[model samples]
Target: MPIVYRLRQGKKMATNDRVWCICVADYKLFAFFTDCGLMWLDTKHNIWRVVSGDMPRKLYGGAMVEYYGKLAVFWRERISNQKQEKIRCAVIALARVGEEEVRGTIEWSGVVATIPYVCGFLHCLVASD
Candidate 1:
């Protein structure tokens, strides 16, 4: 049988809320994004936890990827300019502290691109040789 893990949601999840993105990093940590913001499953403690520092304030349909040694989060939002969608990316550097805690520091974040149409990131991938 497969082991089932339950991630704790800090806030009351509404009926329409959905998981936007999930990614794994070093130290056997699994991170996910939702209306609850970015949270990770700490395998050692068998519990879910949130990142320490700055995180995405307005998280909606988004995607996350493991890039190099950091995590890159991508999401979209409607801007004031002719109702265009603003696609943004945030690079977060992770570090483990106090045995079972993982802290995230945003290395950099900005708008990577924009599209005239309204859409969110359905998926994200990073490949290197």
Candidate 2:
């Protein structure tokens, strides 16, 4: 028989908005909000705490993936004038959870080659290590 599972949202999520990324790890639910960055929702306690530090701002059309038991986020960053009509240049960064830190710190591993402003989707694969 197929099993039916349901997740209940509690008081912790009462004021949370701008939910950008959501993932589950080791039975703990994690959510990354664009406005407030990362937060850990304590399902048992019905509480939430900021994951600490500032996440990349002005992020859009980005992608997040789990690589080798770690999280990796990649986004197209504007490298030129913010107000330029035809601004160019972009960056793809890779970050993972840090160690010995209460709040997870993102360590930018590397970036990908730059590309023109193309409206499409980019996918990444985590190779077996």
Candidate 3:
């Protein structure tokens, strides 16, 4: 089920940014890929929470989605070779740690694919057979 919460700020949510992707997952957690990193909307508390603040690099041009009730992040990392880079996917299990805090734990992370070009962009898509 999808959950919806009212923004107490009484402002418009439709704004332009470098957000690569934004989607809501199970438990009604909405997320956005922004300059402050991946953050999720806490419906219970009506606040925005960071998914991972200690990520290795400054995130840019990536995708975030929900998979099997967990949050999945598609990020790119550069390798030693200039022509090829790695695209990694991380599965994070988000849980309510405290009354005002939600924690995201990486259950699995792996290289989803390797592109033949540097700084490539990938769009988020969902499909099933």
Model 2: which ten-residue window has the lowest total lDDT? 84-93
Better of 2 and 3 by TM-score: 3
Return the top candidate by lDDT. 1
RMSD of 1: 5.3
lDDT of 3: 0.66
| Candidate 1 weakest lDDT stretch, 10 residues | 1-10
Alpha-carbon deviation at 67 in model 2, angstroms: 1.9
Please report the TM-score between candidate 3 and the true structure: 0.68
**Per-model C-alpha RMSD:** 5.3, 7.9, 5.8
Cα lDDT tens digits for candidate 1, 11-101: 4433433456667766455455444577778665667677777788566667778888789888787886576888888998988888767
Give one digit per residue, the lDDT tens place, for model 3 in 1-129: 222333877555554334556778866655554455667676666677676534423445567777888877787777784777788887778776666666677888888888875556556547587
C-alpha lDDT of residue 6 in model 3:
36
TM-score of 2: 0.55
